[model samples]
Target: MKYLVMVQGTQADYEAMRGKASPGSPAWSEQEVQAMYAYMSAINDDLSETGEMIDGQGLAEPAHTRTVTLGDDGKAVITDGPYSETKELMAGYWLLECESLERVTEIADRITRCPQPEGAPNYPVVIRPVMEGAGDI
Candidate 1:
């Protein structure tokens, strides 16, 4: 089975990663950021070598995102505004082909152990199975 493994974060978390201090949040130092990169890179390298990882990428900050909604006239309405500071958003994801849901869940568990500044909030790593075809339904 293939899975979309996602990691979530709030705006406060993003700011902390960028070395900006948010009240009650610890800012990540340069070395801390580098360490995080190295840790995640090691995991990616292992997954790639194991033929499990299909693709992965980090998303831009939530502030740079736009929301689109259907208007009454059926037109696409685009809007960008402040989101709740505590609202968690998808920060990144890994597309993996695994033997089973358990295997993918294990991989996601490993990601939850990624290094972080001491006071950083922990969010759940979500895993969703990808349907191979209509037959999967």
Candidate 2:
């Protein structure tokens, strides 16, 4: 089965990208940042060797995003980012072809342990099965 593993992050995490302190939180040290990059690289390498990873990538900050909706009159309405209303933003995602849901869950669990600042809470990873078309519809 194919599954999507989505990693979420808060606004604080996004601010860290620009070398800015997350409000009251301290900035991430150089060592800490390097450690996280190394950890993610190791995981991706392992997945590639195992032939489980189909595709995966981290996303840019939500400040670069735009929200579009349809108005009652059928015009497109657009709003700028910050996405402040949302508690969590999708930070990254991994698409994997795995044996079962259990395997995917295991992968996600490992991802939660990736390096981060001390005292940071474990963020949630949303896993969903990819539906394949059967050619009926």
- Say which candidate scores most in lDDT: 1
Q: How many clashes in each candidate?
A: 0, 0
Best by TM-score: 1
Candidate 1 lDDT, 75-119, residue by residue in tens: 999978447743888989999999999899889889999999898
TM-score of each: 0.93, 0.89
lDDT of 2: 0.83
Per-model CA lDDT versus the true structure: 0.89, 0.83
Q: lDDT per residue, candidate 2, 90-120, as tens digits?
A: 8899999999999999999989889877755
Candidate 1 has a TM-score of: 0.93
User: In model 1, which range of ten residues has the least summed lDDT?
Assistant: 79-88
Query: Over 4 Å off in model 2, which ranges?
Result: 23-26, 134-137
